[model samples]
Target: MRAAPARRGRDGADTRARIEAVALELFAQKGVAGTSVRDIALGVGVSEGALYRHFPSKEKLSRELFLTRYATLAAEICAIDAAERELERKLRAVVGLACALFDAEPALFAYLLIHQHEHLGLVPEAPEANVVEAVAQMLRGAGVPPGRVTLASAMALGCVVQPAVFALYGRIKGPLAAQADDIAAAVMVVVEGQARG
Candidate 1:
C-alpha cells in the first residue's frame, strides 16, 4: 500500500527542521569550516538545490542555526521569574537550566566551544548578558549589594559555565552529569555568599 501524502505546511516545516538537525550534527562532528553544503544535503537526503532553497549559503545557515538555538534558550531563561525566588534559588535554577540544555545537546555544546573564537561575533551577547542581568536583578531584589551581585555572576559564569564548556569539549575527562552537578553546586556557593553578605 502507498503512504499518505505529506501535508504542505507542517510537512514542509518538519523537513526544514530535519535538514537543520542533520546540518547541525554534521557541522558539530566535522567542524563548520570542514563541512560542506553537499554534505548537509546528503545527510538530509535532499538535493543540493533544495538545500540552497532553504538556506542560501552555508555560513548564513550556520548563523541562523546558532541564533535559533540561542533564542530558544534565551526565551526559556527569560521565562523563569527570578523576581519570585531568592538569589540563591534563582542562580541555582539558571545553572540547572544551562546544565540541562548542555546535556540535551552535548555535541552542539562542544561545537560552540570549539568554534567560539571563530564565531564570537555571532554569539548572542544579549541573551548571555540578559542572564547575568537577571541574576543581578534577583540579587538586588533580595537586598544584596550591587557589587556582590556582579562578583557572584562573574564567579558563576567562570566556575559553572566555563568548566562545563570545557567538559563538553572533552578538554577535561570525566562524567558530564557529575561535573554539571558539581558546577551548579559551586555556583550556588557564590550566590549564597552574595545573599549573606
Candidate 2:
C-alpha cells in the first residue's frame, strides 16, 4: 500500500507553525546566522516565498521563536511558583519542569541557548522572566538581607541552569527529571550557606 498525499493547510496557521518549527530546528542544528529562508522552506517542504510569507526575514523568525518560547517558559515558572511553598521545593519543581520542557522541545532550548546573548534583550523584561528575582525574593522571605540576596540568587540559579546546559551537550545522562532532586539539594546548599553568611 502507498502512503496518502499530504494535506496542505488552508487556514495558513498550520503553515506558519510548520515554518517556525522547521526554522527553529534548523537554527538549533545550525546557528540562525547559518540557516537561511531557503533552508527553512526546504525543511518545511514549502517554498522560500511561503517562508517569507510567514516570516518577513530570518531575523524576524528568530525573534518570534524567542518571544514565543520565553513566554511559554515564563508561564510554566509562574505556575510552579504559585503552587510551591518552600524555596527548595519550588526550585526543584521549576528545574524539573524546565528539564521536561527542554526534553520536549530541544530545538527551542538549543535556539535560546545559542542566541541568548543576542536575543534576551528582545524578551520581555518582566519579573516573571527573571529567575534571579524569584530566587532573591525567596531569600528575603527566608531572612537574607536585600543586597546580599542578589549574589545568592545568581549562585543558586547557576545550579539550575549550568546542569541543563551540560545536559543539552550530552555530557549529562538521562532525563532532567531524574536529576531534579540532586539539583535542588545543590541549590539549597548554596542558598542556605549564603543565608548563614
Candidate 3:
C-alpha cells in the first residue's frame, strides 16, 4: 500500500496555530517580556528552528496574535444586525457579544488589555479605527444623534465594556457576568436618551 502524502498547507497551518496557542498560554502565564521563543517552542514540542519557520520572531508573533484577536472581535461587533432591530435589542446584542467574547477568551483579553499600549503602535491603525467607525454606524442606525454617536460609542466601549472585562478577568473582585445585563441596559438608556433628546 502506498502511503498518502501529507497535506503541506494544512499541516503547516495546524503547526502554526499550535505554536501560537502555546505561545499565548505561556505569554499569559508569564508576561510577554518574560517568555522567550525557546520556551514557546518547547511548550509546543517543536524545535526553535521549526518555531522560527512559523514566526520569524517573538515580537512578530505577539503582534500578529494581538491583531488577529482584535480583528476577530471587531468582525463580531460589526456583524450585529442593528439596522434590523430595535435600539434596545441592538444594544443588548452588542453587549452580549462583547461579554461572550471576553468570557470565552479572558486570558487573551487580559493579555491584550494589559499590553495594548505597547502593541498598539505595531498594529495597523485602520482596523481599530474601523471598529470605532462601525460602532458609530451602529449607533446612527439606532437613531442616536450624529454628533453624539461617537461619544456614546466611546463611552459604551471604553467605560462600560473595558471596565466590565477587567472586572471579569482582573484581580478586581466583582460579579462581571451578573452585572452584564445591567450594563447593557445602562448603555441602552444612554443611547435611547440621546436618540430621543
Candidate 4:
C-alpha cells in the first residue's frame, strides 16, 4: 500500500491556534473592522487561503473568538456564584478572576473587554454562558428584587470592567490584580445599594 501523504504543518491545529492568537492581538490593537484577513494570515505566516480553511471569514473568526472566550469567563463566574454563599464573597471571587485573567492573558482578555458591545448582543442570555445573567443570578439569590437585577448586575460588573478598561488604556498602572479588593468592594456597594433601593 502507498504511504499516506503527510499533512502540512501550516494546515494543522497549531496553525489554527497561531491564527487565533494573532487575530486576537490584531483585533484588540486595531478594531475588528480594521484588522483584515490578510493581516491575520501575515501574522500567522500562512496564506490567506490557509486562514480561511480555519475560519471562513474575519467576521466568523471574530465572532468565535468573542463568544468562546466570553463563555469561558462567564462559566467561571457562574461556577463562583454556585460555590459562594454570600454576594460579597462571590463579587470578590469574580473581581479577582477578572483581574487575574486580564494580567495573565491581556490580549485575550482585552479583546473580549474592548469588543463586547460589538458581539454581546449575539450572546445568549443563559446564565451559564452570560456574565451579566450569572451576576444577576447572584444578586437575585441575595434577595435583590427582580426589577433591579439587571441594572444592579450591570453596575456591579462595571466596577470590575471599568478599571480593566482604564488599565488597558494606560490610565491605570501596575497589575490589575493589585486592585481586586477595591474593585470587589465597589461591586458590593452596587449590589448592597441596589438591594436597599
Residue-wise C-alpha lDDT for candidate 2, range 87-135, written one tens digit per residue: 7787788778777877788888778777878777766656476444555
lDDT of each: 0.69, 0.77, 0.73, 0.90
> On TM-score, who's better, 3 or 4?
4
Better of 2 and 4 by TM-score: 4
**Predicted candidate 3 versus true structure: per-residue lDDT over 1-197, tens digit per residue:** 23334577677889998998887787777878999989999999989999999989998898888878776766666677533466667667777776665667666766677667767665554533345566677888777888888788777677455665567456545545556788788887777777786
Error of 4 at 78 (Å): 0.5
Model 4's alpha-carbon lDDT is 0.90
Which residues of candidate 2, in runs, are more than 4 Å off? 1-10, 130-144
By descending TM-score, how would the candidates be arranged? Answer: 4, 2, 3, 1
Per-residue lDDT value at 152 in model 3: 81
User: TM-score: which candidate is best?
Assistant: 4
In candidate 4 the C-alpha lDDT for residue 167 amounts to 94
- Give each model a TM-score: 0.76, 0.85, 0.80, 0.92
In order, how many clashes per candidate?
Answer: 0, 0, 0, 0
lDDT of 2 at 61: 87
Cα distance off (Å), candidate 4, residue 132? 1.0
**Residue-wise C-alpha lDDT for candidate 1, range 115-159, written one tens digit per residue:** 655655655456433445555555566666776878866776778
* Worst lDDT 10-window in candidate 2: 1-10
CA shift of 170, model 2, Å: 2.0
